[model samples]
Target: MADYVIKTNQLSKIYSKNKVVNSVNMHVERGKIYGLLGKNGAGKTTTMCMLLNLTYPSSGEIFLFGKNPKKHSDEIYSKIGSIIETPGFYENLTAYENLKIISKIRGDFDPYTINSVLKMVNLDQHGSKQFKDFSLGMKQRLGIAAAIMHSPELLILDEPINGLDPFGIKEIRDLLKRLSREFGITILISSHILSEIENIADVIGFMDDGVLIEEISKEDLHDRLNKFVEFEVSDIDLALNIFKVLELKENEDFTVSGSTIYLYTHLSLRDKFNALFVNAGIDVGKVNLCEENLEEFFTRFVSNN
Candidate 1:
């Protein structure tokens, strides 16, 4: 198996006067959840469409399982499944019957596969319920069941948690983790829900205005934003002088935001800085070590880009 289950090199797509996807490069490692995040109309969906061969790229190359997706779409896609936009189903058909039709199309009539996937997605009890009667969450789960029914090596979901309740979202989140960790399936999921993706994604790729800006592991984000003590002081000059005396300013490890300063060091210097402030007749009321969240980290890339 290839180290990267999906790879796109300098992919480009143009529409009339606008460039929908501009030379975006993506790498999805095997058996990992790689989240594609961006603002609305950031070309996230277009990029996925190109990868799945739903739309052809105007330029560049794409490979799935080390085979060209354009030339060998049917052969390569046999091992891949995707649910983009919305899950399509016959509203009148029951969940079981709907999945049964999909199974027939895949040429796999194994009733056990259908039942197993249904149970895995928590839709087993809704077997006789018509698709129209299923809730939004149940419908989403049923869509996932259809996607993985054939046991594809790769699963692509676009906004899997869209319009889902908190409980529903948590359920799907756990399911995706189970798919990656237990079944060893690589998932390429796109969503504007940064926090939810943060919980499940092993790797994250940020896309903006039709281009990929950065791709980093979840640990990399924590390591980058970690070890910074942010504080709000009444006197900015006094704080600067104290940091300078401590040789922290010499290393450019200090950042000022209005009346706040992020001491890019360790929390061990909490008492040291506090004492310096008191001796200097400066009052320090609130000092907090900022805990990094996915949204905060994601903002850095989006704004900078």
Candidate 2:
């Protein structure tokens, strides 16, 4: 329990007989980024709300830093900062000003931290920009800056990057990674985007239909991915037919996408397959051994169950 910053035991949340979160035992290691991943309405936000005490669990216990939150709400919550969806800031307030107000409200106003957090979120350059004028990505960064201004040991954010552009997503991703690595701030962030979480989280907890189906480390998930050999050739049909003649099945043994055909069977036969393609007068452009992506894994995982 001491090792985990946030630990849950059978945490369940039911609303009008529907279990939004059911018997989820989540473990968030100290100083690690834990990504709670699920599709919309998979009870991800509900689980986070339970952890923040925004809502109560139906029949489970929550432990933060090995202490019961119910017993030490003030002592526990003071060390945590969170953004549930979008956090509010004064529309006319500058990035620095909004955090100044937050710092004062939290009664830990340190002038140095105001600038430091802004710089960390890349908002220092836009220090004078009003919250209303900031771009969506900048707004998100400001929200993060406000969350961390007090230097909370743990930060919980729910779907923080749900509506950002590619550049915005990368901005927030790098910021979170920096917070975890440089500042040692433990983060519990939730998102429906598997690819984003796969990029940022140290550990991932997969949920569906209100149940936590799997919890695995990022490295372990990669190791468990299904391996396939992808080939790019001058002729797609000829290459595919070669496998077809050998009685290999589409999807089952291989799948063709665009100009490439992937082989799931005979994983070690890449060289042989390449030789066969070359002998068949097919120009082999390139070949790669790719693993099943997080999305592919999630789809297959849910389909199997």
Candidate 3:
């Protein structure tokens, strides 16, 4: 089992009469990507703010590296790096200079760290050009370079792929995955990009209206999201009779599409089911599992919520 680098218990934040984040209990395991997903105005950014100590929660507790930030020394916070909203940069300064300024604040400026992080985020080419001259995607990459300049153990990024094109998005995604896999940095990434999360997240936490509705591993989600095994049989009446003898739970939950009968189970009961049909003078055409994509699966949760 992986150690939890960060954990929250019943965390919440309210503004006047409305709750922006309500009872959001989530965890980020060490060296793993935990994708915090939600719709717009669904409290993902607010929850991330509470985690980073940029915004105070109305009630509840949060632990970073197994200690409360409120009670711990400032040294404890130095291990974290975050890019909550748009990362501010000196438009007059080049990417390297911007990172140099950040490194100076921590009193650990080095050419090696700057070069290493720039290469990690694929921003090594932006040397002398000022920040204003960089494209939106280039700026985002430079922002990430700044975040990791100090070699922090935890990195929290919200909407990290907001402005990037497909190639840029892929580059950022691969960099994040490598960060977790190679450097052992824990990541808490908040984004509505389900496909992006699906590609990298080891664990996924779904937030709805400020509340965490579900938390599941990518492997477990695959089992659940593999909706049903469909079979097309030539005889409907014979198939229905065999289904009755199989004693499937909640018969109404199963559906038939033309000649195909969808059975919602991981185990393939086709051999047994087919034999029963064949003995009963029915022909079975095909049997296959029908799995929904990540977006469709997420929509099912949101609609049900």
**Top lDDT hit:** 2
Runs in model 1 deviating more than 4 A are 230-268, 276-287
Name every residue pair that clashes in candidate 1: none
Question: Which parts of model 3 have CA positions greater than 4 angstroms off?
Answer: 229-288
Off by over 4 Å in 2: 232-251, 256-260
Regarding TM-score, does 1 or 2 come out ahead? 2
Better of 1 and 3 by TM-score: 1
Error of 1 at 233 (Å): 7.7
Clash count, one per candidate: 0, 0, 0
- Against the reference, the lDDT scores of all candidates come to 0.87, 0.91, 0.85
Error of 1 at 81 (Å): 0.8
Compared with the true structure, what per-residue lDDT tens digits does model 3 show for residues 174-254? 889999999998898988888998998999998888889999899999987847777788987668777776666445546
lDDT of predicted model 1: 0.87
Among all windows of ten consecutive residues in candidate 1, which has the lowest summed lDDT? 245-254
> By TM-score, how accurate is candidate 3?
0.83
